[model samples]
Target: MRLHAASLYYFDAVRRAGSIRAAARRLNVASSAVNRQILKLEDEIGAVLFERVPGGVRLTAAGEALARHVVVVLQDFERARGEIEGLKGARIGHVDIVTIEGLTRTFLPEALGQLHDRAPRITVSATTQGSDRIAAMVTGGQADMGIGFDIQRQPDLRQAAVARFRLGLVAAPGHPLAGRPWVTLNDCIGHRLILPDASLSIHRILRPLLADLPPGEGAFVTSSSVQLMYRMTLAGLGISFQTRLGLEPELARGELVHVPLMRQGEPMWSELGIYVRAGRSLAPSVDLTLRLMADHLVAVAREG
Candidate 1:
């Protein structure tokens, strides 16, 4: 069965927006036009793609199946266009990435900036998501790449590169724990603690460590935002625990101190990984970005 590009475009937009009117607004087309395209697609496929919900639409089983193929088809089309541009001596394309929130503060921006400086014609779009969602996006072909900690393992996703970082206590420069070589959970519980919320993989890793702490010894505040946790720590409200991946600026400026978390004098560590869909060939721009990211992660890992 063949579907027109416009029909597939409208179908994908409606799937994303959940409503024809909203998708029309996004596409800058009339709602009736979008609806006609969707109807035409359903007629060609001979399946009801969406179920009408009260305020929006939900995908049917057939819709779900088609959506997956649609994502791959659209991505392949974009890649082919990029290759054609390359053949014409123009190196231009877009790379879509989904990453964990922690990288936004420093790692991702720096890497993207470096890529832009070297390849001015290439553009990038990045969204911050939790590790699980990042993995799903990469596996489903919704994103070209994912960067996060402990990405969910899936048959269709491959870990392109990884770096291991020891989790550490972060505090303002003059905080009481600043000079410590390493600290145990028991030592940290005595002070106010800013903790990562369950959305972050770090929260899962640290859960067992905090589980044995005394009843009243718990987090002063919990949040999913790494930036918020860093700011609170800088304000001396509490100490926070995280990898050193995004802490370079603060550590370099002496704005914060990071002491490794320890158990029996051994540091606690977590793996940060880059993921891409398996059995797929990446576009040149996407491949370049991935290489740069892998190089950057390797540098950060060696800094430990």
Candidate 2:
């Protein structure tokens, strides 16, 4: 059955808001107009798309199936428009990215600076989120790409590139363990530790290592913010366990030192991945940003 763009857009809004009136408010249109388009779509498809409830409507199996196609169709249309603009010698387009909080402080800013130098017309909209939410943003079409550590495999997302970053102990220059090439969890437990909380991916990577330490010798301070953790480390409050990816500035300025977290005298590593929605073609601006980020991440990984 043929469907209009208006119908698909109205349907998508209803699915997201779960209430026709709510969707209408968001779309700045009348509720009856939104309902009429959805009804037309259902008639063309010959099936009830939503299960009307007292508070809101829920997508039926048919609606769920159609929603997936609608996302792809709308995204493809946007990509096509961007490509057409590129063909007309205009490099103007927007690239949206969702990344881990750490990158915003270090790698992302550098990468975006380079991107702007290369393509001044391209605009970037970036959001910092936890690693777990990065993949979901890409899959949902909210962001063109996601960058994070320890991202699990998702059916609707693909890993475009990856870097394995070594987890390490970071401290101020005068700290006792700062001179060490590597340190074990037991050795780290002897001092105050400023550690990432369960919300951060680094926390999960260090969980096994922490489990190996004496039961009561956990982190002295646990936080989800990378910047706060880094600041605490620089202030000589405690050593933090983290990757070198976002610590380049501090390391270069002699503000912080990174010693590899050792297990049997070898460094522990976590995988950092660049992700995009599976089976979707990227727009020109997104493709360029992905390449730039991949290059920077691979270089950082190699150095780590």
Candidate 3:
């Protein structure tokens, strides 16, 4: 009747990562080994923990119930481990953070600089991904905290506004549109555009503004490569649309220009929020990071 820690770790990893393969990569283990441990854990608990769903794994009803307890158990175990490590004069701990792409470009570097300065011994690993992925990571327990835009308020999650920003039309300096005081949505339709892919939050925000245009068209769609977009825009591929923060360095360097839109007063405004699981107690390192996050966001808001 003894439960093994390895089995618990496997169950938690699969639940967090949403797939066995992802869990294996995160844990540095063979996928089959992770699966075997999960099977053993299910047998020990006498309950199924995941359902094989199309696209990815899902939690069954029982799995959902077990997931709550498992998260608490694992979090407490991690806290205990951290406390023990701290007793040895080491503040070793981990905080899994998911963030939107804009912050990854500008916000995260400065924010993490603050965190690192305060807790030099604490390790903070961040995952730079799309908003949808951040939502899933925060809800599914893959991330201890998330910095994102337009986060959903779910019964399983708690959030606080960290910052706010709006989208802007960006193009390489000296590009044809650069001198324009304002560019219209129609102005972009036929032109080469290096905008965010349809799946990104910024793109989603701009969809309605560009809806009159036919499908399978945009100028160009891109996912996570901001530098590539900068280069592409400079190369005359198309005008890129992104948060102003993302274009700051290029804008300052005269490599990119942020142009306001004529059709709208400003592009869609989005709130950057910090989120954590609803009922979880955060570890010291995570709590400190959250505090630093709040301060940083305030600073960003002031500059905004």
Candidate 4:
């Protein structure tokens, strides 16, 4: 006998609720109505569906078997519903977003704000990790999309440039290097320096110059929070290196100054971009987020 979808739904609801009265409460129906459906389903299937107990109902062996199948059917139906609703332009869904800690504070919020305004029902769950971690999370399927500077393309992922940025030398106000027209990397060596970890592309490019600096002089090496590091520099911790976008507010406030460094001429400077898995299918909401991300990048570049 073919089981009805309503019968399966009511059966699962009763099993979860533990009693016909509770099931009725959950389904917004009368207790008698719930009992009638369960009884009708048992008669049609020719098996006892539940065992009566002192306080409530318990599923019989057959009922337990049917419950497992009912759950799968219900879950599959819900998945299909979500897929269809997405195509219908329903904004109700979730997107897992990963990005570097620095961009999350400055660039991402500006972009995400616009995304939420345009698609209020679509929710973005964002997590801030280091650049390498962000790349790993996206490639590993832990996140749907990512926003990072100097994105690395893994075999399983594809990257599209969303914006371009370059790492620059920044010093706190009243610091010795603040008024320089431009300084070579060697010139920066004498002063205390705060640097990004050598593992990142920016730092890797700066490594030769950084290594040439006088021994025991490079003061800081870390990743993933330029804002905090910049603050530390303002506190006179050291001269920090950061992306121009990250230093915008500080530069505007005159709390920090950008001192140009020798351009190595290699594309060590590259565009910040969006990355998605190459072969994996993306949800419509995620695709929309990527599109918005591109637009935001263009706007950011233009404004600068």
What TM-score would each prediction reach against the true structure? 0.93, 0.83, 0.81, 0.68
Scored by TM-score, the top model is 1
Candidate 3, after superposition: displacement of residue 80 in Å? 4.9
- In terms of lDDT, which candidate is stronger, 1 or 3? 1
Pairs in clash, predicted candidate 2: none
Candidate 3 steric clashes: 2
Clash pairs (backbone) in predicted model 4: 162-273
- Looking at model 1, residue 279 earns an lDDT score of 78
Instruction: State the C-alpha lDDT per candidate.
Output: 0.88, 0.86, 0.76, 0.73
lDDT of 1: 0.88
**lDDT (Cα) of model 3:** 0.76
- Give residue 163's error in model 4 in angstroms: 2.7
User: In model 3, how large is the Cα lDDT of residue 152?
Assistant: 61
> Which candidate's lDDT is highest?
1
Q: Per-residue error at 153 for model 1, in Å?
A: 1.3
lDDT of 2 by residue, 57-157 (tens): 99999998998888788777767777888899877688889998888877899889889988899999899988877877788776889999998897989
Q: What is the lDDT of residue 205 in candidate 4?
A: 63
lDDT of each residue in 1-304, candidate 4, tens digit only: 2244577778878987789888999899888888988998999899999999988999999998887667556544544555778788686566778887677666888888988998888888888776667677675455778777776667877885576665567887788877877666766766776777744456656777777767777766465456567678888777876667766787789888876655554323546778876665565677678888888888888776
Model 3 lDDT at residue 199: 42
Comparison by lDDT, 2 against 3, better one: 2
Q: Report the Cα lDDT for residue 3, model 2.
A: 41
